[model samples]
Target: MLNIAIAQLNYTVGDFTSNVAAIIGGMRTAFARAADIVVFSELAVCGYYPGDLLEDAAFLEQFEPALEKLLEASRQMPKLATVVGTVRRNTGAGKPLHNSLLVIQDGIIIAEYHKQLLPTYGIFDEYRHFEPGQQTACTLRIAGHHIGFLICEDGWNQPGRDYKINPFDALRRAGPELVISINASPSDIAKRTLRHSTLGKAAADTGLPILFVNQVGGQDQLVFDGASFALMPDRRIVFEAEQFSEDFQLIAFDEGNFTAAGGAALPIPSQGLSTEEFARRQIILGVQDYARRCGFSKAVVGSSGGIDSALTLALAVQALGAENVAAVTMPSGWSSEGSVSDSQTLCANLGIPLYVHPIASLVQQYGAGFKDAFAAPLQGLPLENLQARIRGTVLMEYSNSFGALLLTTGNKSEISVGYCTLYGDTNGGLGLIGDLYKTEVYALSRHINLQAGRELIPEAVISKAPSAELAPGQKDTDSLPPYEVLDEILKWHLEGRRMPQTEADAAYGFVQQLQAGDEGRQLVKRILGMVARNEYKRRQAPPLIRVRARAFGSGRQMPIAAKY
Candidate 1:
């Protein structure tokens, strides 16, 4: 049996040097296990979703030298055959760009393959940078078997496009003993079913064992959940890798036979927690990753007794724990009575320290100072934002004083359609729920409460009308459409179709035609246009946990200054 290892690794975008080190570290683990072949995710050396930097020779320059390092490292392990990824140069006298996977054995480059398919649609524009390779799949002779390899976009799709060659056809003709596919595929809720079915099809069609390896961890707005796996000749998952984290698994095969001797299935992250539990767990993972990567640990948040603060505090408590999480509650003239009490409830439940300071007098003091400068009545959006800004300022004061990461709790639905203050409520080192739509936030809250079989998010918190409460009587529905309608439109329009430039050409117009005449021509175009227009805010907003299929993450690249 030929033993194989799939390195499901976490990598940061633009951290070229560290990425190389990670690749070597993972390789060393595989060698210690005494595996015959060790494979890594596509583009693991340079991180996936490099965006337009691929067009810059300087970026590729930073990427190529790592290949030599891997080759050099291979010398240390004589028995291990390594397959790793890096950007490669195009052969002809054209702007050189090729997504590549290289196989090295005994300090020798045995075979190198370029990606055959270059995805140019939604969230991908590989055609803009990399030139597709027209070669058949390359095979490496390992452990008395001819094993084939393909890059991220190769051998995983069934397309009718002229640009990308069908590598599977060529590889099938070559009749390799095993076909290995490497990917930097993105993650989402729907991923589990889709990956299972699609990989099953690949295994069934090839009748040859197929190994699929993926990347893990967050990069900018994207989070890659590494659910790497191997499909046996029988079309069953013979080997499985962990999800949402980095791991290494070994699969042994003999000629056309397969065996999985290592790696265990990881339990899914506990998604349901009391309001205290849910917010804490998701936020902790979220805060821990973003803050730790960006270089911070302790964090502080505005701890108004409101649901948002309650939620953000829950997350911070989980992430930084009681000692590390600091909550500052600043109540202005309009701040409700039970707000502080609710905030205290959450902080007490989570065992975190709460700081209560009045902002009402401060606002009055500032208003008095600005009496001559500002004649407008203390109301409307301006007045509402003043309170938020004051609270934000206080949170910042605590954050700066203690060198703590600041967390924002605006949910996805609010961030979409612009319901938050730019430098006010939106200010923070990271936005934990920025990608989770409001409806999802409530659902997640409810799920946590139900699973815990007790009141975690406090019944009053969940049962109360959802409001920002910046004003005396402000509600979310007053400024926006029902969340149900907005979220549905978002999922379909944002991730389903391509964005068009103007109102007439916008995909939204097609949605109007849904029952007009044709069933097929959809309004998906309009939705994507909205997403494109909103890219500026997303770019400025701190990175968020990427749990959705097309979260505005590294995988979802949009041109900042593009026409249509």
Candidate 2:
């Protein structure tokens, strides 16, 4: 029997020291567990998707020393083989490097395989950095068992895919007893289910038991859910790891069957989290890691007593404890009384301190100065924008004074329709819910309350009509359609084919029904135009935690200067 250790770890990009140390630590733990081999996720060395860091000579220079250190560490545990994902210099006529996997034992490299497929679409641009590996299968023998190897995207090409090559076919031809695939797959809505369906089918078709390992952590706009698992040809997921966190486990493989480390039956995997719970955990991890990496221990948000800000504050508190999160309510002349009172109640319920910073004076000064300088009254859209800008500036001042990261509170709907001021409400280091639609924002907020079993977010905040509160008695509906209507339209326009089949079909049908009527067609045209015109604002906005298949930052790329 061969004992295989699955190491699902969290890695920080460009932090070679911490990453290598983590690898060595996992190796020692696996050795202690008497495992024959330990498997780590893809790009474990310098972290996954290092982007332009791959081009830096100095950054590339660190890999050699790090590898040497791993080699030296391997010498100490010669009996245990280690499988690691990293980068290597490609001595061929292509890109300067290749995404590589290495198997090391006793201070020597035993086997190596470069990743075959490099995805270029939807937040992945592997082709821009490294050359693809040759279309071939790699396998190795250890402890009397034959094991085939695959990088992340290699295993994605099933029988009927459009790719030129199928690595699984080559692996099948190699006729290994088992297969091990390493991945750095990022998490999205329903992504876990998709992984299971796709990989399970691939496993059954190949008639090979497979071990899939993945990494977990937040990397800027991306968050990886490490729901690693072992799949059998019988279409069963026998072993699975935790999601949204680091996990390690050992499984014994004998005669193409997997069991617990000590030859016991594996426990069945749970059904997994709901969509809302998944988003909450994902955003929490995103905020935690983003703040920890960016050197901010505390976070602050401008509390408008609306669902958006309330939810942002609640999520920030969950990520960094309530003591670490602060709320500043900048009430203007047009602000409702419930704005401050509701914010106080929300923060009080959350156990976080609330600071009331009235922005009415700041708005007056800005409006007066603008009128005097420009020789015209600042009374229309500019006046409303001045209020948002004043609030933004006050929040920034608080952030600067307290060394807290300001969290932006615009949802995807408002952002899509250019309902936000560029540098005003968008002035923040990171966004927690910018990828979620206005309707989704409410759904998640209600989920939070239900999960807490109390009114953690005041019901007044959730039930109140959505508004910017910049102008007197202004509601969001005054400018745009209701969230129920606008969200579906934005989903069809922004996500389209990228959304899951159920959502895509629903959104498409809703849009088609709207297009059938002249007024609805005009509204759709206007909404589309608003989304197209606001590319500049989104381009300047802070990076948000991505929960959907197609988020704004890297997933959806559109040229601002071009006409549609």
Candidate 3:
């Protein structure tokens, strides 16, 4: 019988001290548990996707010392073999380094396996810094069992479609008793299901029990949902770690079956969180980690009393706590009475302080200055944008004065069509709902209230018509289609085939039906044109927590100058 511990940890990028400390902590726990082996997630040393930090000579210099530290720790727990992911210098052709995994036992590095597949699409660009390893399986014999290893992407090509060389096949040929796959996989709506299906199929087809371990935490726009699990060839997922948090578990493998550490049969994990609940947890973690990493203890959101701002405030309060979150209502002359009242109710429900900074005087001052300087009355579109800009400026001033990170409230629909003023609602350190559609914004707002068993976001705010309140009687529908229609178009156009298969088919069919009529076709064309023209705005917008497969940031790279 072989006992293995899964260390699902959260590592900050470039923080070698904390990362090593966490890894050693896991090792110590595994040692106490009397486990023979402990497996950590990919890049547990310097964190996953270090980007350009891998290019720094000083950054690269820290790895050897970190490994030595791990080696030293391993010497204390001589019986436990520690498997960790880090980087190593490459001597052969191609990149300067390779994404490597090391197996250490009794202060000796017994086995080293370089990652063979380098993923370059979507949010991953591993090929930029690390060279791929040779197409050979890395297997080691320990505790009377043979184990094969794989990095994140190596196990993804089970269908033999993504990459030419199937690492699973090669590992199968080598004939190991089990396979251990380490990953830093990011979370999305259907991503957990995808991982289960893909890896489960691989395990079932190869008849190899696979242990998949992953990291959890918010990294910039990416959120890695740990949800680590062990799969059997016939049983699929038998065990799963917690999602969106750090977890450590020990399992025993004996006679080709995995069980609890005490040799009892492991119960199958639950079906996991719903899509709305998943997004809430993901965004909360994103806000928490982003604020902490950026050196801000508090977050401030401009409260418009609309669904977007209300939801942002609620999520922010949950993430950073009510004491660490503040809401500011910058109502203008055109602002509705419900705006301030709803904001008050929302903040009161959320247990956060609300500050009202009336922006009517500020708008008048800006309009007067513009008329005097430009010799034209600041009315029409410029005047409307001026109110948003003044609110944005006031929010920024509050952020600076109070040392709070400003949270932008623009959702995906307005952002996609360029309905937002660049320097106005777009001005924030981080966007909380930028990846969510306006409809999704409402859905999540309702979800929050339901989860809280009360109106945390205020029912009045959720029921109100979507508006910027920049001009008298202004509604978002005046500038764009209703969110119900607009979100479908944006999804079909922007995400396309990248969406989940069912969602993609629904979006495609909805768009095809719209194209069946001339007015609908014209509407589709106009929305597409708006999206194309809004590239410049999105390019300048703040980075949002990515909950979708194809977000507006690095995932969707569109040229601003070139016509599509």
Question: Candidate 3, residues 1-564: lDDT per residue as tens digits?
Answer: 999999999999999999999999999999999999999999999998799999999999999999999999999997799999999999999999999989999999999999998999999999999999989999998899999999999999988888999898889999999999989999998889889999999998899999999999999999998999998998479899989989999999988888999978786798889879999999999989999989999999998888889999999988999999999998889999999999899888989999999988888888889889999998988888988888888899988999999999989999999999989999999998999998899899889889889888878888888888878899888878888899999999999988889989999999999999999999999999999999999999999999999999988889999887
CA lDDT, candidate 3, residue 253: 91
Candidate 1 local lDDT, residue 139: 85
Which residue runs of candidate 3 sit more than 4 Å off their true CA positions? Answer: none
Per-residue alpha-carbon lDDT of candidate 1 for residues 1-564, written as tens digits (9 for 90 to 100): 688888898887678889889888877888998889999888888888787887666776886587788888999989788888788888775547788888888778888888878887545677788877767768878878789888766755634254445677788788888988889887555554566666677667777778888887766545566778777657677566766668877767775765655433423323222333433343445566677777887888877676666766665665666788888878777767667877777777777788898888877777776775777556578778888888878878878888988888787777766677766787787777776777777777666566657665676776677777778777777866577656666755555542213322443554454536442333344434555676677677766765555666455776779878
lDDT of 3 at 209: 96
Best-fitting candidate, scored by lDDT: 2
- All candidates' lDDT scores? 0.71, 0.93, 0.92
Question: Cα lDDT for residue 53, model 1?
Answer: 80
TM-score (all chains, Cα) for each model: 0.84, 0.99, 0.99
Alpha-carbon RMSD, each predicted model: 5.7, 1.0, 1.0
| Candidate 3, residue 521: how far the Cα is off, in Å | 0.9
On a 0 to 1 TM-score scale, where does candidate 1 land against the true structure?
0.84
